[model samples]
Target: MHMTVCLVLAWILIYLCVMKGIKSSGKVMYITATFPYVVTTAFLVRSSTLEGAMDGLYYMISPDLNRLFDPEVWLDAATQIFFSMGLGFGGLIAFGSYNELKNNCVKDTVYLSIANLLTSLYTAIVVFCVIGFMGHQTYMDCLDNDYKTLMTLYPHKYGSLEELKTSIKLDEYIFWMEHQFHHSEFPLLSNASRYCNYKDIIASSAQGTGLAFVVFTEAILQFPFPPLWAVLFFLMLLMLGLGSMFGTLEGVITSLNDSHVITVKKPVLTAVLCGTACVIGLLFTTRAGQYWVSLFDHFAGSYALMCIAFFEIIAVIYVYGYRRFLNDLEFMTTERPGKYWTITWRFVSPVIMLILFFSSIIKSFSHHPVYSAYDPITTAQVDTAYPAWALFVALMLVSLALAPTPFIYFVRKFKIWKIEGDIPAASKCLGSTPSTTYMLKSEPSFNRMVESTASELQTIGMNGPSTNGSARNSENDRKGNGSNRHPPKRN
Candidate 1:
């Protein structure tokens, strides 16, 4: 019930924000977009002062140039770029469609792309700082706990606490302890013993939501005013999530409206769409929600995104004709696109996307879907693989986004063939086919009449009237100039 209420409220908020289309969302975005950055900046400033923060920053920016050659690194980088920019998703296209024809889309794209990358880097800095703090805290906890144990166990060897502390070399002591207590009967002792090593503390940190909620929250609790920082951190996350949801919902609404799939008032359509999404989202709120979310994240989010992107590039550059697209851009912008844009669109983007798409497919098939399952008692990841059937279902989920492209393409082609048989020649290039010749041929008489009328009008204009008739002829021509040009041909 709590989940349902949250879901409904979320949809309601989204509906309210975008019910009036881009106009409403555009106003709301001014706040939603800028506020997160402010929050992120605050977090970054606050986190930088924490103990061991520089270690995190070093870990993040220490570049191994050799990693560039690794396909896995490239794949990860490409995935981050795609998702961060919301490129493969229909949301960016839907948002852009609302722009005026004269709007400088090139400028907007360049600015937004740069902003997105910078924002990602900034967020990473904040995240790793928090992680570094966590690492530091964990290391201290392990150090103190192990130090107490050492004092308790070897009090006789060292005469007094000060003497033992002065005599012990911390690093060598930790190494000796870890080797000594490697398989202690007490689980807590064993775990604490392991953490005495700095590498173990670093290894314990997680990624994704675990890092956000678990690790960061843990770091927040160690701060001067825990509650204040906690609230601020959570608020930042909520705003970020809401901003993303707004764009995603807007994409669905815009697509539906453009396709004429739901012919209703905007508010009514918004309600229906949001309500439907909320209902579907209920699945993720269930007990096994994490599993389902992970499944979707793997198959639908990652794999399908790349596939959709690949096809989108192909359809635009190859199917729609890149040169014609550029011409259309020229018409709108009053300037031709540069060779850089043309080359990237025509070749570079498509080839790289195609490679990524196939690589993802190969990777998906090669490895079984195995998510880190946490043990409730230990809060440690268990080595448990998802069932085969669940992976199969995930594959089906991937097809949900991908299956429509080819299906819609064939459907459109069939409709064209049905309406205009033998009109569009097979050899004729897409978007470059001459005006339907078959339609023109079928109305030869009307065409001839129109041609004759145009010729007569031209002759009248060329052959100057007699001096007496000149004024009256010119007056008639002035009154009927538009009609004389090219009247609509009747069947």
Candidate 2:
């Protein structure tokens, strides 16, 4: 019930931000996006005073080179990079379309990428410091309280650390301290020592989820103005989450509108999308919601992301043609891509993405997908595979996400869902014709969309919307009557 209310509130917030298109959401971002920095700085300052916070700073720790060969590490890194840079989600493209035709997107992208990297590093450091403090507290708690009880249960000959240190190896000491015997009575096992193992403590501490609650809950209990920073912290998370949703929902909304299958006002469409999503999302608020989230994430989050990214790259570079893309980029930015771009886009990116996509597919089939599960009795997190029916549902999600790529390809290839003036299957599928492509056409600038000249449009294209009275003259040209001289600007 709590989750349901929260989900509804979130959807309502999303609707308010996005309902009027970017106008309302753009204003809301001022609070959502910037407040996190303020909260984080506060955390950083408070965290430094923590008794053993530095113990959590993985940055100060030496690198473990042995993990480089790990496949899981590579896959995880790929997923992080994709999501971090907003590569596969279509958000970047959707948002970028709003930019002016002459916008220096190259510079903007580079700056944003650097900012994103730094932001991720900063956020991780904050999380690490907090986790480190938690571990230190955990260790101290076990020492202060649990040690006395364990000693009473099983008397150790060496009542103190100095004597116990000589009797047992550190490995055995760790086993006894962590209660590796699963809370059972063992004759050789003794009480905990005063010496705290910071290494083991930090290593065993969980990061990410539920961490913020623990951190802020403590702040609310211990700090002055208890709820201030706690509220800010939660709001930071809220904005960060909604910020991503803003772009994703916009992409979905825009695509549906552009599909020519659905016709509705932006407000109506936004409400419908938000309402439908809220209904679907209610499943996530259920008791089985965690399992459903895991299932969707396993299939859609990883596998389907790679599939979408791989095809998008292929369609643009391979189907669209390298030279044509360069030409399009030049037309938009008035700058041609360099040799480095050519090499990476045509060869390096495709090869790497292909390998990763196929490998994920193979791994998914070879072994069952597992999710993180907690054992209440053992007080430990464990990996558990999905049940057979759950696995089937997961696969269906993957298939549903992926089926459209090939389905649309064949549809367009055979003219099943023919548009009035789409390029032929040979031209589209095989990239046989360059002149018919949008490569030579200029992407319409909202400001100058009213007044496009023959000089502005390098070629006559039939696919874009009708731009009859479009001119280079003035804003009033936006209302100009149809003049067959200029073909429609690409939508």
Stretch of 10 with least lDDT, candidate 2: 424-433
lDDT to native, each model: 0.67, 0.65
Candidate 2, residue 427: Cα displacement in angstroms equals: 17
Candidate 2 per-residue lDDT, tens place, 304-403, comes to: 7888988898998888688877765665456889999999999998888788777766766688778878888888878888789887788788888889
- Per-residue lDDT of candidate 1, residues 5-31 (tens digit): 887887788888877776677788888
Candidate 1, position 156, lDDT: 69
Give the Cα-based TM-score of candidate 2 against the true structure.
0.79
Please, what is the TM-score per model?
0.79, 0.79
